[model samples]
Target: MCGGPSAVVQVVHVTSLRINNYGYLERMVPASPSTWMATFTRVVAQAAAGFRRSRRLFHPWGECFAGTITLLVPGTLGIREEYPCLVRLSKGLGFVGAVPDALGLAIRIERPQPWDVLMVSSAGTGVLGRLIITPSALWTRPCYSTLMPYQRADGELMWLHARALGGHTVSVRRNALTEAIKGAPLGFELLSGASNGAVHWVGELTLERTAEPGLSFDPGVNQVEYLRLYPGWLTAIRSSAYLGSRQSRGATLSD
Candidate 1:
């Protein structure tokens, strides 16, 4: 966690993913499903109205909300092959939108950070009035790995890019090496690691926001009015409950 004295960390990722449209299975498909999964999930979550009120709770303006992270992945990665887990998690935590697909993936974290100095500065000078600013960071670093182009019995190249960030890497190949050595276990670990990195970056940004003052709170402004107005403006930041739903879930793991 990164903040002044108190902060909460949340992590999320995909556990199991599957591409339903593909008739036959390919070797390189599983290694980096989360990337594709992330992309699909966001679209689904938005349609479901997830992540509605994430910005206001975690910055210097609000009550300093912390300690929550959420991840989205495919259902094939779960220990129980449970389909409802994703939806249950998303709706319950307000994270919603964990979809599975074949293109690319994404992971997003919501934490309170300071409004951009320029935004606040403009507000102070009356150029911009009553704005809701969401200062959060997103990381979508991709990883790459080599694979031998091989034809399946159907004569098609099963190749995928194995990229990783944070502390995990997915090794995709056009062979059985992935399933033979690690199988489902290692895939779960990799997803978790990526989620951790996403959450860590959010925490870092929240802490950075506290050190910077808004335009109204700048040194030249009256300290008393600046302090008095800060909380009121924060009230406009809005608040939403982080709950689990049918398409998403909280990323907290139990030992």
Candidate 2:
């Protein structure tokens, strides 16, 4: 287990991650599918069709919101401060209406050189649970993970995690995400590292308002100068997906 909310951890990269007390030896992180290039092209086209031709490949139908993410894990995540941000809450697999799907949270911290954090619903606990993507039925008190590792600016590998604060449950229906938080803010506990070893509580991510839509978040392109989304192959796949989606939809970046 980790220390108190105010505790600071000395972060380092090792060959394993322990989720919920289970010591899991780190395994090779897969970045792309088999025969990725040709396969990826076909996947993008299929995704476009799956999303009704004008939506993103995965989180095609999402509502963008304005909020802030307070980063406070210190050494591992760099520093602590509240940053103005834009958040898009969506369902993975491009499913429409009320349905179980991998809940996606894409956050873009506003800065001269902003940082994009893309997380999907996952157990973030057991080996299989952490590796496989799961569609969450509810949004309250749920766990989300990077599903892969990223190298900190200092070259330390770590995974970013988030959890909805207690008593914040909401439905999975279309537009229910922003609706449920009209009066109460949708909050998350930002974390770094894994529980089996040393988990650092980064801070809170609070999404409060439903803003006017039309923002496309491309994590591969809009990231802090040199933030490395590690396991190079995955980055390539992600880059291709994001690029293809935007090109197909004729979308542009927005705040």
Candidate 3:
């Protein structure tokens, strides 16, 4: 599944291969069109042989790997138009899955579970974060029956929190939350638990529909307020201070 304005999703997959260098001799023997065609045939044969051997030995999840690569390089496929270059690349690389339906566009890799990657994207936007789910989870839980959509203060669709991060509180439009429930048949329940030692979801929320802008809340307030605009920018400064303090203590112990 993908998200966004339905205009940015694209996915592509390529296989990995290895080749031996037969440098001077091979180069000197391949100057004509027929020779080049023969060289291409040989390369394909070798790649196929390698793929067979590797599949038997490691059996690396090619689908997962291709999906990961698609997230990293969405525009590599022509989600908007035909991308012959990507098509050729996939063929040459020996991909063994369905041809990418969309042109390569911007995609994000959503991390849902430890070992699984779920692909989500808006209609046209490339894939979003990879949401990985275990096979057992798939069997036990309903998939895509319900989705959570987050909205910005201006009532615009923002990020969707498919899974909760340990220390992050997602701020979303109240109406959007209700809409998500109504749009999907899955039963909805508010999250109530401790995250990062802080109590979350302490009260019932009433959903309202209006044009008014929502309030944005900042959960973390470090002393360096001047650098608030740049989130995580002062991490290095904090780390340095912490290390220096430890060093001073170590010197004192030595003395």
Candidate 1: regions farther than 4 A off:
1-241, 244-255
Q: What ranking emerges by TM-score with the best candidate at the front?
A: 2, 3, 1
TM-score of each: 0.14, 0.74, 0.15
1-255: candidate 2 lDDT, tens digit per residue: 365476667553322221122422333333344233423443455445653744556676677888888876444546677889888777777666666888888888898777788888887644445556778768664578877777766777777778888666688887787788787788888877743436677789898888777677777667664457777777877776666555556666653
Q: Put down candidate 1 lDDT per residue, 123-180, tens digits, no spaces.
A: 1111121121211111112221111121223333222122223343322221221232
Residue 77, model 2, lDDT: 42
What lDDT does model 2 reach?
A: 0.69
Top candidate, metric TM-score: 2
Please report the TM-score between candidate 1 and the true structure: 0.14
TM-score between model 2 and native: 0.74
Better by lDDT, candidate 3 or 2: 2
